[model samples]
Target chain A: MSAQTVADKVDRTDRLGIQQPRLPRLAPLGIAAGAAVLAVLIGVLGGLGSRIQWGLIAAILFVVGLYVISTVVEGGRQAKDRLATSLVWVAFLLAVVPLASLIWETVSKGIKVTDGYFLTHSMSGVVNVAPGGGVYHALMGTIEQVLIATVIATPIGLLTAVYLVEYGRGALAKAVTFFVDVMTGIPSIVAGLFVLSLWIMILDFGYSGFAGALALAILMMPVVVRSTEEMLKLVPNELREASYALGVPKWKTILKVVLPTSIGGITTGVMLAVARITGETAPVLLLVFGSPAINNNPFDGGQASLPLYIYQQWGAGTSASFDRAWAAALVLIVFVMILNLLARGIARWKAPKTGH
Target chain B: MAKRIDISGLTAYYGDFKAIEDISMAVEPRSVTAFIGPSGCGKSTFLRTINRMHEVIPGARVEGKVMLDDENLYGTGVDPVSVRRVVGMVFQRPNPFPTMSVYENVAAGLKLNGRYKKSELDDVVEKSLRGANLWNEVKDRLNRPGSGLSGGQQQRLCIARAIAVEPQVLLMDEPCSALDPISTLAIEDLIGDLKTRFTIVIVTHNMQQAARVSDRTAFFNLSAVGEPGRLIELDDTDKIFSNPSVQATEDYVSGRFG
Candidate 1:
């Protein structure tokens, strides 16, 4: 009945019967270290060329060793449980390894050429094969084009989502939903070609950042609609009913109550869409035609974006160009990272104050 | 302003299935009327028809007349939105607009009607909260989210929001069902005070609650499963509890059967 009695009863039972055994908390760590040593020795003797292979072998041996040792010390069920846990840990490391390596590779290769001078100056007179060029023009073009695309896409996407959630009915809603699904899977290159044919060839507009933006807007819209729709659906029907019972009209209820309630999620979705289109190179290459000199007016002439700049630099196939490409890639990743952080900040600031 | 309700042969349907059968009754102004019924008896559905809240659901329709004082609520040119302004409602569960502060939730209805100066809005919000017996509990935390309040407090906040607009009639569908006994008693006391200014209609599953808080009581019942719920009887609360005119009403009032 009491804590002392329960403990005495358990102690008496343990002394009278066989003891239940468990491995120490640090057992897995010790086993992992042993497995690593064994894997490295096997790799050396077997003449395996890559450390990646050694890591894979180590992960496998660790899981297998954990299962066998746990079975001997504990039981079959505990062994299976440990095996599952180790498998999940190995999978997590597998996922993390590529991402960590990518960031490491970008930082190491890009750090040499990514100074203030590289960010402030443009490649007006510099050739692609030389090492003096910068990414100033590409940064400006990406900022302008992505901003334009977001401005174009967000309202359209938001309204479409509202219609689907609030007032949609019958065949028309289904058709729109089907089309949006279809559009979400459209290849980025196909969007580029569509924009090039329509905006440039038929409309007789020259290659410009605006043309690239049109394609980016096409890609951003469906993602926004999907996420916004999901957020809207999450709003409880009771809130809407409460608003209606207070004599608020449907549109006013949606605008004042529903939209405000889900604004954080909607903003997050829009920011994610913006991030997706920011790194798009296919549309920029086909429509904007990639410029080396800075062009502030996106409507009139060709412009460069970071992704397109990276592609062009890499295509040059020179050591200097390769360095420039790596630096541009790093800059692009940092830009996206900043945007994501800003998105999170906005989400927190705008989130409904439901907690104490 | 309080207004009387006069219904005549009112029938409601959810798609092709009838929810409530043709029934008629009159509810006096400035009095509390409680509707008592078993589960699935359509008491809540009938209450929704007063403000045309019933038709808000897809394929849900109503037939016959609902007269609010001199105006027919189902008149050809009358808008449901305007009708709702005169007939506010409190739902079964407390829903206080999680995005809004307590002050904002109370002022939401007024904001919809028209623009108001800050001082005027503040006065109405205070008056409404006080009217719901919630001003003292929530006055200091007016700027906090309405959802942060206790369950009983949130329901009172919803009541404050409903009364802020000064509706003639206030319908409550089990407003105290989700609350504890103390909170239920608090709301019951508030109902006694509110009946002087608004025509109050409440649907309650608790028979003792109806006997305690209502001036008049109506009993609704269904003949069998899938049958449309029909009004069995309506009478003064004391008489209905002691000596009801209908056999079903007597059976229900005495707790012999539902």
Candidate 2:
């Protein structure tokens, strides 16, 4: 029925609307034909001079020809839609061109020095030469420091979230929420400097991986707390009521029913927050004094991480160091990508099955 | 087999604001009583007070004597939890735990308070579902999520959940308001049958429902301008609907004041 109506309307428009028309589609078609003929003539002329620029000129004429034909064959609505669509495609192409170019340039330039030695060796001895360079120590340092940070941050973050969601009542909860909000927007370098001053200047302890972890903890705690708080809030009040109506105590309700219901979302949020802080470089640089060889202890001395390794190698300016830096960057990106995929997978798996 | 409830001089408050004042009533054993009133007239509040569900709302307080089998529920050292265990409630919205299956939803109250053997749980689940008149339709799909059922089934599931712990006094707050006419008739019939075993008190806005399902009816109305709720009459349902004592009850039943 719809198709028949549309066909009848089309017939009516063609028969009745075109009866009083001359060049109903003529002016736009004429202009389009004229431009195409001109583009062909230009191509013929350019064939004698140079054929390369002819491709570029023909592309431009084709676009201009489309604009002319559209304006004539259709009314303002169709013409405007065509114009907007063309412009959108052009804008998309413009964006893709630069992004693709940057990615291509990074991969091509950065892959030259990336090798197995880049993974296994380190910048411990010798000089800034093209032959002796790697990020093995830096990679070890990064992993140990981030693991230490996770240890320091996870309990505090989860506890704070539990308190806020389960027991928080009035002014105290508001105060904690306000502070967490402020902490989320804190500058990374400032957090590093703050932790550095508190431990090194006040307590008079030298730089260690623990200090770097502390700074990263400052950055990570607020994120974990906020995300976990949101996940906890997503748990339905009916679950709490159901538990309470069963004569379960308040603490038990929160622990058994509420936490179990929101566990999936909480895990995803925590992992995402971990991915966020694992790549931090500024605080690590300020608190961790890097070494060429791996130091597993986080509390005693300076350590290196993947971000720090990339920064050091990129700043060193030796060809081999530059290659190691690119390799470290590639590794970090790969780690983040894996974390993202894991987060998505966990979210999908944990989402409650609605129908049984 | 359960005992009766004797409520005297019951008054409810939200913070400092009095909601229902100087109300008193009794629910006999193995009988059904109904509270009927307009919206915000505090019929539901009075119902919640009997089961101590009123305390769930912060700042909600009550001053009253609710004696169930010679024990004063409002007395000091009385755990509201214990009171609620004996006096179960079904809410206006049929809130079966959405995350639980049909069997789990019925078993929630029993499992949460303490541990029960699997054999005991199976017995309780079957009995409760049978008592709510829902066993025949849902017995085969006991593992299905409670939320997947139709609205009427969900309400029956909630009813089954409430009765699973074998509470003596069942307080239903507009249990049939969210149901269809067919479902409402089924619930009304269930209420009539349930009165032979459990003492039941229900709050309902539907006058016809009060007339259809209740043995006794309590008529509630606002006392004065800007004042709290007051009970106008409590009598047999037939007398209350046919020829009430108070002019207020008559006017209300005849759609004058309300």
Q: Say which candidate scores most in TM-score.
A: 1
CA error at residue A60 for candidate 1, angstroms = 2.9
Q: Residue-wise lDDT of candidate 1 within B1-258, one digit each (tens)?
A: 899999999999999999999989999999999999889989999999999999989899999999998899999999999999999999999999988999999999999767577779999999999999999998998999999999999999999999999999999999999999999999999999999999999999999999999999999999988999999999999999999999889998888883
In candidate 1, position A133 carries an lDDT of 80
| Top lDDT model | 1
lDDT agreement of model 2 with the native: 0.82
For B108-138, candidate 2 gives per-residue lDDT tens digits of 8888777688779999999999999999999
Backbone clash count, each prediction separately: 0, 1
What lDDT does each candidate get?
0.95, 0.82
Candidate 1 scores an fnat of 0.73
Task: Identify the leading candidate in terms of DockQ.
Answer: 1
Residue A195, model 1: lDDT of: 93
